[model samples]
Target chain A: MIQLTDVTKQYPTKSGPRTILKGINLTIRKGEHVGILGRNGAGKSTLVRVIGGAEPPTTGTVEREMSVSWPLAFTGGFHAKLTGIDNLRFICRIYGVDFHDRLDFVKDFSELGAYLYEPLGVYSSGMRARLAFAISMTIDFDCYLIDEVMAVGDDSFREKCKVELFEKRADKAMLIVSHSHRYLKGTCNRFLLFRDGTIQEYDDFDEVYEKYKELLAEPQTF
Target chain B: MASNSLNSSSEGSFRQSLVVQGRVLHALLIREMLTRYGRNNLGFLWLFLEPMLFTLAVTALWTATRTIHGSDLPITAFAITGYASMLMWRNMPGRCINAIKGNTPLMFHRQVRPLDVYTSRILLEFGGSSASFVLLVMAFWAFDAVALPEDALQVVVGWLTLGWFGAGLAIVLGAVSEKSDLVDKLWPPFSYLLFPFSGAAFIVDSLPDKAREILLYLPMLNCVEFIREGYFGTKMHAHYDMPYVIVFNLVLTLLALGMVRMHVVEADYE
Candidate 1:
């Protein structure tokens, strides 16, 4: 189980301090698949980052009772000059895996072909995404923090991933952040809507979708 | 064996994890070297090329000045011994200063401790510098430029001591820079101040009494004194203190380890 009690996050802007999360109280249980929805600048990324332990809240506690795989496709953490094989070995070493034992498994799972021997700087977006996803899946964590960075991969891989990540790992909790309603509805069991520094949970995706449509259906008021 | 280890059936699996982490640190060192040298056709030759070129330039300047300065050795030998040792000490702390912040991605792996990054960098610098030292000795022999150390063990002890001293200081600077901007601003001045004590261009025996007394307290001077004793076959004139170097380095290493432990490992990226 993961719990956040009275979590708050504030950022200093040119104008003044802007509060992003104000006293957010949340608890996510095992076997839960949650989708976070908010318009641009609604703190969706900030919320996930806080949960992943990438950022700490200003005034609250986050208690994670299970291990988490954070943002499976984040490229910011990799050394660009390293070959994919070396990167894989480094990641394996860091994760305490016997890299030589899993070498073939990682190679086959990534499907990176000859390009795996080349420096990662030479990889295309899709290839890098494949590598990231393959590496994260190698370790079975109790929860996964998913961002939409994997959307660039081809359709077949996406379908395979959806099945493996959601259906196969149904026991693992998921917090998915994406702008696509169809994608969220298909993968998630519940919706979390953020507005004005507060989060409102919707037990049903349909109810949140209806409200989202109604909110967007009106003409511009600004 | 695989089944026992894989299933955590072996009672020693916990200890084995530390070995795995060390190997991980070694791999990171290899990655750093490959990225630094760039896979040009020259390949690993640049490792030797860099220190050799610097040693030669300094040798030329010393010869032109014709200053033997109380040492019974030739100018090339003095330059080779002093400059090579200084090169190792000089480069390590500078490299370690940014080591942690540079590998931000490695921190994401929960198994990769921040201390591992520092260790990998120190080892890599040590390897490169040690190689250069051996290569210089070989080059001197091939050219008949210098004779073997009178007592080779002292030479080895001195170099090892100097390496640890550099590593200790590297740890301190690495930790200090992570917390404040002062290191970046003060580093050049610090380097300049250290230049006199580093024994780069001059032998320690050349200094006056007051100067020699002050210079003897510097960690690098003990190293140079010990190394020069091996080269010149005299008790190194700068007082050659061993206990001081060891104690100072141990304190610095502990301080660095403490600073590293205090870091959050995340959320401080900016």
Candidate 2:
């Protein structure tokens, strides 16, 4: 279970402080897949980051009773100067898992045979994403947090991700933030629409999709 | 009944948090080593070699110049003891200042705190410099270039005090630099200014009475004096107050930890 109480996030800008989230209260129980949709600058990514414990809220509390993984396949967590295998070893050590045991699995899953030994700085975007996906999959978490970078690599790799995350871990809870409504419709059980620093939940995908379309069609007030 | 269960569970999680922090620190230490000193061309050997080279250059300069200040002691011994302690204390804050910004991605992990980042850098600085100091002393003694330290216990204690002081200062600087750009601009000039008063070049006993009294207020100066006393023994007089250094370190450590806690709370992730 993950719970957030009165969560607020603000960033200092050149023109005073910009408020991103305003007193958000949320709870996600086990086995619930949540999809978050938002237009540009609507704080979808910030909300997920706060939920994943990557960033602390400006004012509020987050209580996590389950292990929460970092945003899946996000390259920000890997050190570019280190090799893919070295980055894997570091993450494994911190997570208190045996790196040696998971090495073969990550190598086979990532499919970057000899590239794992090379520095991550040298790896192409696709290779880095593949390594990130494989490592996140190797580590078992009660809940996974994913940002918009889900559809990485070619068609085959996308299929692999869908099978690994959706088919294999069907029971695990997931919170995904994405602009692709079709992908969310296929994956998520519930929907959250972020607008004006607040969230509105929709139990039905078609209903939320209509509302989302209306929201997009509306002219910008500011 | 629900509250009771919540309290018990929270207590259990607290203990688990400590274990997670330990594991994260261990991982960070290994990552620091690998990234800092890669597997090619002398690798980890450079950790000790860097400091040894600095000390050797300074010692050679002092010997060649014959710049003795009313003291009959060997310039090599004087230079090594002073410069090694200087590097141990001075390099730490510089290394720590922008550490978090460089490893921003690592902060994504729930278990990796800002404190862990500073701790790993501090450990590397302290460990590398401390090892180099010990090795240099041994080498010099073997060559009959310097005498064995008079009191090994005092030397160890003094060295540890210096490390503790450096670690605490580094933590504070690391957190402060994260908040403001001014610290980045000011620290270099400030550190250079501090070098002279750090007691790296002269003994406290050689200073004028009024100058000695003021230098005593600087904890780093006391740390250097304590170390020199251990090295030179009764051959030279060293002025340092142990209790003052201890209290200074304790206060600075508490302040550093408090600053780090604030940084973690206020940290804005990208």
Candidate 3:
């Protein structure tokens, strides 16, 4: 379970302090899938980071009872000079899992074959995304942070991921951030919309998405 | 692990935090080694070999100009002791400054804190320089080019003290450099500028009382003087106060950890 109470996050800007999340109070229990909807610059990513324990809230508290994965498909964390195999080993080491056990799984899942022996600097974006997804899946986390960054690979690969995540590990908690209403509607049991530094909970997808469309049409304002 | 009553990782127990840090450091150490050396010929052996080669060249150069080194001390021994200590204190900070900026991606993992990043680099540096120093000393000893130190215990203590100083400085500067661009720009030149006064080139015993007093204000100089005393024993008079060096290291470590905790925010996260 993850619980956030009176959480606020802000960044220093040249003009002044820019607040992102404001007094956010939330609780996510086991097996809950929460979809987050926000336009660009509305702090969906920050909220995700805060929930995953990657970033501390500016004020108030965040309590997590379960292990949280890093943002899915975040290739940024892998060292470019390390081969795909080495990077996989590194992830395994940090997560306190055996690398040899996961080696075959990743090799089979990522489909990189001999390329896994080559440096990540040599891997294309699609290859990197595949590698990232494969590596993160090796770790067992109670909650998975899914940013839109996961929107990669071909349709078949997406289908494979759907089976792995939505079907295979459907009971795990997830906080998914994306602009795709169809995807969110298909997967999430709960919804939160970000506006004016606060989150408004919505149970009805059609109602919240309609509000989201209206928000998109409105003029940009802080 | 989750069976414990404590739910929040941020507020997790001390033992849990330590285990996590150890795991992160192990992962980071391997990552640092591979990224630094790559799959090229000789690879991570360059860790020791690079420093060893530098020391050997300096030893040869000093031997060629034997008369100019300002003391009757064996140039090879002096070069090994002096250059190895210098390499530790010098490069650790260089590796640390802007470390977080280069490693912003790693910060995405909640387990990879700023201290782990600084420590992994410092450990790699300490290991490389120490291996180089020990290898050079043993190799030269085998060849009858230099005698081993008179007091091995004192040498070990002095080397550890010197390492503590480097790690403290690196952590502090690494944290500070993230907040200001000036630190990144200034650190390289400052490291070079410190070389002459760092007691890496000349013995503290060779200097006049006044000059030695002034130079000893620098901690690395005092550390080398302590080490040289271990090496040369009664042959050379070493000037150092262990208490002063220890206190400085303790305070610097406190300040470093404090600054890292207080100052490091998420780097460029939107």
Candidate 4:
């Protein structure tokens, strides 16, 4: 189980302290699939990072008993002059995986083909995304946290990701952050709408998503 | 209870996997050497040659001075041996400090520990500098220019001490550099100041009385003196204390390792 008790994060600014998350009391049980829906600048990414252990909460305790994987943001590792195959092997070595099995999986799933033996830095943004996604999905984790999931790669890659990860890895708990209601509704049964400085959970995603959209659509003169 | 998480079956296996990732660090070091020096015909040959050239220049200049501390030893053999060893002492620490910032991309890999990056650079610096020393010694022997050390084991011990000292310094410098950008400004002048006290061009015994008393206690001076003693077969003008260097480095290394654990984790903060 993962629990956040009375979490509050504040960042200092020229004006004063800007509060991000205030008194965020939450618990996620095993095998729960969750979608976190929030507009830009609503602390969605910060929540994901904190849960992933990439960052610590400023004023509250985050207790995690399960392994967590955060969505990959960048692809390049050291020795950019090396080929994609070489880089994969290097990463596998670091991660302590048997090179043959992981290598085959990455080669097949990433679809880099002849480009596999060429320098990875030369690969396009989509190719890099595919490679990062393929590697991250192959790692088994109890909790997978994703941010801006719909923005990467193409439509086919997205569908392929859903089939390979969400479908195949159903027993694992997941937290997906995205603005697309259609994708969230299809993939996630539960939703948390982040607004102002706290998260509000809703068993009915449609109801929460509608309210979230309505709130976002109406702009003020402030 | 805390230990249970660390001792999990998967965690044990995961920790074991880091050993494999350490090799990637070696590959990165090779890339660092090549990219910095350029892939010319000379390639890595310069790693050996640079120290040798410094040794040769220092030897010639000191030889012209006739006598050092009224000792009759050939200044060429004395300076060359000491100077070459000092390179190993000096370069490793400086390079290790910059290792993390240099390979920032590798930090994203869960398996690539921060120390692994520094360790790779340390290994490369030691290997290159050690190779240069050996090559220079062999060249001198091939031409019947100088005699080998009387106690080969003592020379090896000296080299190891110098190496650890360098690693310790590098670790602390690396940690401090992350917090403050002052390392970039301080590094050049810091290295320049190290030159006079390094026991490179002259033996600790040869420094005029007052300077000699202070220089003998400096960390690398013992190793330099020890290496020179091995080559020259006698303790020329002063005796060296080895225990001081070892103890000081061990404490410094432990402190550095702690600081690294704390500061390095901050880099990944979201």
Model 3: per-residue Cα lDDT over A1-222, one tens digit each = 788899999888889999999999999999999999998999999998787656668887877777778888888889888899999988887777889999998998889999999999999998998899999899888888899955798787778778888999999999999998899998998999999889999988998899999989999976
**Clashing pairs for predicted structure model 2, backbone only:** none
Go through the candidates in order and give each one's DockQ: 0.30, 0.49, 0.43, 0.24
- TM-score, candidate 1, is 0.83
DockQ of 3: 0.43
Give Cα distance to truth, residue B247, candidate 1, Å: 3.0
- Residue-level lDDT tens digits of model 1 in B111-222: 4556677777788888888887788878977999767777888888898999998888887788788766688678768887887677866676777889877887888878
The candidate that achieves the highest DockQ relative to the unseen native structure:
2
lDDT of 4 by residue, B1-270 (tens): 111121223333444444444455755565556555545648677876776677677667666766453466765567667667767766776786666766655644434557777877787788877887888888877877667778888788888888888888888888788666788678768877977677765666556678877777788888888776766766465458888898989898999888887766443231
Per-residue error for A137 in candidate 2, Å, reads 0.6
Scored against the true structure, residue B196 in model 1 reaches a CA lDDT of: 61
- Tens-digit per-residue lDDT, A95-166, candidate 4: 456678887888888887888877656888787778778777655667777777558889898888888777
Q: Is candidate 2 or candidate 3 better by lDDT?
A: 3
lDDT of 3 by residue, B1-270 (tens): 222212334455778767877888999987887788766748767666766677778888877866566678887788788889999998899899999888766765767877788999999989878888898889889999899999988999999999999999999888989878898899889989998789878887778889978888889989998998899898787889888899999999999988987777532121
Candidate 2 lDDT, tens digit per residue, A2-29?
8888899998888899999998988998
Question: Would you give the TM-score of chain B in model 1?
Answer: 0.87
Q: Which runs of model 2 end up more than 4 angstroms from their true locations?
A: A218-222, B1-18, B265-270
Best by lDDT: 3
Better of 3 and 4 by lDDT: 3
lDDT of 1 by residue, A76-168 (tens): 566678787777776665556777776676677778889888988999988888877777777667778888854768987777677768788
